[model samples]
Target: MEVHAHTHTPRKKWTHYFWEFLMLFLAVFCGFLAEYQLEHKIEKDKEKQYIHGLLEDLHEDTGTLSETINEFDGHLKRNDTLIKLLTSDAIKEHGSDLYYLGRRASRSVRLALHDFTIQQMKSSGGFRLIRNQKVSKAIIEYYNRTVFIDYLNGIESNESDEYRKMAIDIFHPVTFNGIVNPDNTIARPENNPPLLTYDSKTLLRLAGMVSYIRNTKQGLMKAEIEMKMAAIELIQLIKAEYHLN
Candidate 1:
């Protein structure tokens, strides 16, 4: 029998094969780690952009709010001037011009307030979030009452005492009776004796409207400032969370 020489190359050692397998595994793992890091960076960048955009939107909204407040303040100042003019002897004696001016000022104030209310609604999704329903309802009722006065003013003559009382009612709707304990029920003008009975019903209604406006203004201002602060805080949180700086 011829001696058959098996001249196959010696198989690699088990140790060498083990090392080669480990090297291949490590390479794949390294590639996977690099891909994961790249994807993570991309995601983070997208989030950063989103936060920056939101911050910009908040800033714009804040600006709009500030502008609205400024306009409202101006309207209030003008209304104050008109009130002074209405009370003056010269305007009262002269009659028609001052009466018209006063009426116009009152109308202007109400219109400005309406615009402000609309803006507030847009900014905060209505007063319900910042103020209680009772307060909001009071405000709406006051506005309706004022609108009624406006309607009456259009037809009624200014020289009548009824009109003068109505104007006073528009200005001073609330009166303080004896101060009471917190537990006691508050006394309002309607419950108290009427100072002017000729048009007491009309005057009382107008007084209530004015009182409602005054009370709601303070609450609205506080609520507005709080809303601004909340918006600013949210913006800061977004900046920090997304590393938007």
Candidate 2:
């Protein structure tokens, strides 16, 4: 066997190695930047989606609150009328009118807050995605107020319950039935409200009912006003933060 001389290839220069390293580093850096941009875009989109959902919820809440406010205003007026009638001698002759007034006052208008979006944010810990600190704070404050409103609503419901109990004690069930026909129309039967006047005990019950209605009405009115103001403020904040009209 003949021995051949082996020629070894030259090692790469350091500059060559450095250029290769630089190229690899540049490529990786570009890819990382692209990925970061994509992630940022996704986060921004998610934030906007949350904001839009919150806007819808706030709008719904405001609308419902307006309707509820109007309904409670009517309730307040009816209760006021009942209070006046109860204090007058005419109530002895027209006890049927008290039935109408009591029926209105006894109704509880539950204000349902639109909290689907907020609840989701809270449960999922998505509130961190909101970049605007003001928006986050406003949302928190609004929900907090809602909690108070709910407590007030509970008190109002209790008052309404008491009023209903008073109604059961003072008015005959059969007589109340006489006020509404089977067709659901307003009607006054001859035997409606079998009694026209209340004794001392019943009058005392009426007085208590009137006092409760007044207190409930006042508390509800204040709560409604505050709720409306909060809603309006939140709406404005959302609009400003989201650049919405």
Q: TM-scores of all models?
A: 0.43, 0.85
What lDDT does candidate 1 reach at residue 143?
A: 35
- Residue 192, model 1: lDDT of 26
Indicate which candidate wins on lDDT: 2
Residue-level lDDT tens digits of model 2 in 170-205: 777877766776775445444335454466567667
Regions of candidate 2 where Cα sits further than 4 Å from its true position: 178-192
RMSD of each: 16.5, 2.8
CA lDDT scores, all candidates in order: 0.45, 0.78
Candidate 1 backbone overlaps, count: 0
Deviating ranges (above 4 Å) for candidate 1:
1-9, 71-198, 229-245
Error of 1 at 228 (Å): 3.0
lDDT of candidate 1 over 168-200, digit per residue (tens)? 543323332232226653322233232322244
The collision pairs in model 1 are: none
In model 2, how large is the Cα lDDT of residue 105?
62
